[model samples]
Target: MKTVSIRNPGMSWDIAANILVPPGFDEGKRYPAVISNHPIGSCKEQTAGNVYGAALATAGFVVIVPDASFQGGSGGEPRWLEDPEQRVRDYRDVVDYAQSLPFVDPERIGMLGICGGGGYSIKATIIDKRIKALVSITGVNFGRLMREGFSNFDPLGALEGMAAQRTAENGGAKEDINIFVPGSVEEAKAAGIKDIDVLGATDYYRNRCPAEGAGTRMLVSHAAPAVAWDAFAFAETLLTQPLMVVFGDKPGGFGAYRDGMEIYGRAASKDKELVVIEGWSHYDLYDNAVPTGIALDRLVPFFKRHLSDMPAGSATNPAEANH
Candidate 1:
C-alpha cells in the first residue's frame, strides 16, 4: 500500500491518495478497482473510506482513496464549503483518473461511499458508467433526511430557515453560520431533540472517524441548503449500473436501508442487492465495537463478488498464472 498524489485539472491541484496494489501489480495485468468516497468534509484517511478500501485491496481489487474536492488535501476555493454538485463532480473525476491507470481495467471500476458521500456516490453513478457496481455505507440521503427526518413522513421544519438562508445567499439577509452540521440550538430547541450543542454534535461526529478522531475534516457554515436536493426521482433509467447497498440495522441506519431498498428495488438494472446489518447502528458501520478489519470484511466480499470479471484462482498476474 503506497500513498500517492495526483494533480487535478486546470490548476495543478493535488488530490492525495492511498493506493493498495497487489504484490505483483507492476507485472502489468489490468485489474478491477474501487474508488472509495470518504465522509463529507473529511479526508481519505477517515475511518469509513480508507479502511473499507484496504479491506477491498486485500480482497484482490486495486483500491484508490482520493481526498474529496474541497476539504483536506484536495483543492477547492472558499475552503470547507460543502457543495453537493462539486462533490458529485469529484466522484466522477476520480473515476476518470482510475480508468486511466495502466493496471486498471477501464470498464471494471466501482465505487463505495461512506455517510454523506454515499449520497454523492449514488449521484455520481447517474453520470459515470465506468462505475460497474456501487456500495453505500450508513447511506445518507441528505435531501431525504433533512426534509423527512428519520421517518419519511416527518420533514425537518426547514422551510423558513432555508428560505432565510436563500435570502442571505442572495444578500436578502445575513448568513446564519450555525446550521452547518445540523442540530443547532435553535433547530434543536425547535425540534426539541436532546444534546443539541456543538460539543454534543461533535462527539457523535468524532466517533465516526476511522483513525481515532485523527482523520476527519469539516467546517461550520450554511454552505448549502442541501435539504432541497434529492438524488432520488432524478430519473429511473439513468442509473443502469449494478448496485449493492448496505447499512446498519438500528434506528439511525433505518432510513438509509429504507432508501437503499427502495432505490435498488426500483433501479432499472437487474443487478442490485441491499444488505441490512442486524442490530447495528449507523455509526457501527463507521467503526465502533468491531475493528476496522471486521467492519470492512462485511463490505469487501460484496465488491469482490460484483466488481471483478476475472476468475478467482486464475493466474491473475502475467506469467505466474499462465504457467
Candidate 2:
C-alpha cells in the first residue's frame, strides 16, 4: 500500500490518494483497477473505504482510495465545507490520474461510491465517461438530507432560506446558529429509534463509547442554507455502464438501497443490477462486521464480465504453440 497525491492544475490543489497492490503486483501482470470514493466528512483512512480497497487488492486488483476533497488527508481550508459540483470534478480528476498509471487497465476501471460517496458517484457518471462500472452502497443524497438536518428526512427546503440568509449577510447581520453533533435525544427519535438517555448532557454527548477526537465545528451549520442547490440526479441519466446497487435492510439503511434500486430501474443499459443485504446497516457495509464477506465479491465479476478480453492472449498456451 502506498499513499500519493495527484495535483490538479485548476484547483491549484493536491488530491491525496492511497494505492494498494497485493503480492506480485510488479510481476509483469497488469491488474484491473477500482477507484473507491469515501464518505463525506470522512477520509481515505475511514473503515468503510479502507476495507473496500483492501478487499479488492486481495482479489488481485489495484485499488486507489482517496480522501475526498476537503475531507481528511486531502487538502481544503476551513475543513468540511461541502461542495457538490467540485466533488464530481475531484472524482474525474482522480479517475484520470488512475488511468495514467503504468500498471492500470484503462478500460477496466470501476467506481465504488458509498453513502455520501454514492451520490457523488452517481453525479460523476453524468460527467465522467471513463468509469465502466459503478457500485453504490447504502447511498445518501447529502444535498437533500443535509438541507433540513442530519437525522430528519425532511424536504422542507434550504434554498430560499439560504438565499434570504445570504441577503442578510450582505445587509450586515450577525447571529450564531448551529446544529449540534449527533446523538441528541431528539435526533435519536428523529432517526426513528428509541433514545438512550445520556445524563448531564449540556453539549454534544453520545450514549455509546466515549466520543473522542470529534468536535463540533459549528460553522458547518450554514451547510444547509449555503448548499441549497440541486444535487446530481442518477435516475435522470440512466448510466449505460455496468451498475450495481447494494444496501442493508436495516433502519436508516432501507432508503439507501431503495433509492439505488429506483435509479437502477431507469438505467439505460441492460447491464445494471441491484442487490439488497437482508440484515446489514449503512455502517455494516462500511466494515463494522455483520459477516466476513466483502461488498466487493459482487464487484469482481461485475468488472471481469464487462471489461472485455485482455490486450493479447492469455488462454493460448505459449509453450505449446510450437507443437
Highest lDDT scorer:
1
- Per-model TM values vs. the true structure: 0.75, 0.76
Per-residue lDDT tens digits for candidate 2, residues 15-130, read 88889886677836556788888765456765434577777777767888877666556776545556766777888888888767767766667788877778788778756777
Candidate 1 lDDT for residue 255? 62
lDDT against the true structure, per candidate, is 0.64, 0.62
Highest TM-score among the candidates is held by which one? 2
Model 1: pairs clashing at backbone N, Cα or C within 3 Å? 47-210, 147-155, 315-321
Q: List runs of model 2 lying over 4 Å from the truth.
A: 27-29, 147-157, 160-238, 291-294, 308-323
Backbone clash count, each prediction separately = 3, 0
Model 2, TM vs. native: 0.76
Steric clash pairs (candidate 2): none
lDDT tens string, model 1, 1-323?
76666666664566667787755566357788898888654567765445677677767888888776656767665456666777777777677677667677766788988777888888888777767788777667666765664223444445555455666657745444433334334554566555322333344454334243233333323433565677665537888777777776654422666766667776676777667777665655665546344446656776667767544324444334324
